[model samples]
Target: MRFSQILRFHLSNNKWTAKQQYVPKHNPVLEEDIKRLQDFLMSKSNIVVLTGAGISTESGIPDYRSEGVGLYARTNHKPIQHMEFVRFANVRQRYWARNFVGWPSFSATEPNHTHHAVARFEREGRIQSVVTQNVDRLHTKAGSKNVIELHGSGYVVKCLSCEYRIDRHEFQDILNSLNPEFRDAPDMIRPDGDVEIPADYVANFRIPPCPECNGHLKPEIVFFGDNVPKSRVEQIAKMIYNSDGLLVLGSSLLVFSGYRMVLQTKDLNLPVAIVNIGETRADHLADLKLSAKCGDVLPKLFNFKK
Candidate 1:
């Protein structure tokens, strides 16, 4: 099956089923569980939400870390680490080339139901803050006020040498001017906003430099090997410390940075509830684990007046 078809299939059918009596498959939010979660939220003055790539997958953004759906998987290559991309000039060229090709579709993506639901929760004061591992700025676009992007966003690319920032659109224009022959080239676009191109062609592609400083430009994100900024980490820690409880959405919590936050919530004796599809690393830590689609559960759960 094609990538788009596979995505549609997962979206249409993915859900959770109940094994116990008096429980429903489509409705993973049991009345008892809802009461527990609702009471938890009501008692708390502040509630924190930790989100991941899964939250944005519904908006047609792909999870670049997953087995079959990620950029590395599509190319049958190991993921390019942060250090490698930064150190190797050819790697940087390929990286930018892919970014140039896939920029349009990624830039065009809009926020989905889950994003809107979370944003609404924040707006209504149901959620105090959101810490996300995703690079997509859908949370902010959906109207969320206090969002901490653990990984950087795709919309902004920065120069490695001069630290100059350029919008993705502006960088695309530069790529077009430099490589006119590749303007109409066809390639498979990956979920992480990267394109699959021929290795030889990628090796020869010319990447643009910072117009003012002649520095190397790169996507502003926490690459695979890069650590999340300490200041951002401290900020999230403070948010978690201040919040009554932590609510996790659509994340597996596979990475240590996110998982550590969930662990901290548990250590603080705060309730941690999770809404996700598969088994997460923090499943054991979750006070209530709702194994269901976020789009289905979040709206009802965070709809304060209801």
Candidate 2:
């Protein structure tokens, strides 16, 4: 059954199931598609896996733009822009306050089967490397060693004025000690571990400065209004150039950073396969496209038991 005009094909009866617990709806069409994907992977020697927020959604994080369940569909909350965080003190205060509340759960999230399957592919020499648009370190947690976090990582915090860096866990402790009175529950958690809290909490929150250099502290992430570091782009381009094929998982590819990889793969005349729940920006370029969740398709693709 199609959902509106978007042509979403569900592989399960439920669209929103817990991570690693996806039950196939037993659609024969989906089964055939899975077989095709398996054959496609078997034919390739070195495959590059590109991932985005959909992979993490099964782990209970809400992304920015899904049909009905995304953060934008659910709320009008906008993420902190890069210039806003740099130019305004209040923006940093709000960002840190929300991040402080959401950090515990976000940090504690475990890797799902999709991540494990990708790691398994690497172990078996079926894939060359991974390029991920997610800030969450689930890919690394799942044992994908050659992951390129194209958007940087939320597990790290760095000073803008210097090379000073600290593990995000360590910074959390500093936040705890400085803001003892500003405690509240979060309404929701974004993909990057940010949440919605009271405006007053943001106003009263104390953002800690870098102890080493008195510089501004920010998560090691490429914010919406910021560009991905050029060196990182070159790294991904090189990876794609060396790989034989591209496997896109769970990403809509709306962001140019992720989408351009697909474009590059096509320009190189390499085949591309996409497994996502909705229409992606690079669908026309894909040699094969399956409208299904990553948790459902990845296990079958890797021959992992459901």
Best by lDDT: 2
- For residues 194-267, could you state the per-residue lDDT of candidate 1 as single tens digits? 46787876876788778879987888888889999899899888888888899998788888999999988988
Clashes of 1: 0
Clashing pairs in 1: none
Give lDDT tens digits, candidate 2, residues 93-165: 8888878887887798778889998998898899999999999999999999999999999999999899999
Residue pairs with backbone atoms closer than 3 Å in model 2 (clashes) = none
Worst 10 residues of 2 by lDDT: 2-11
Name the lDDT of candidate 1: 0.75
The TM-score of candidate 2 is 0.88
Residue 42 in model 1: shift from native, Å? 3.1
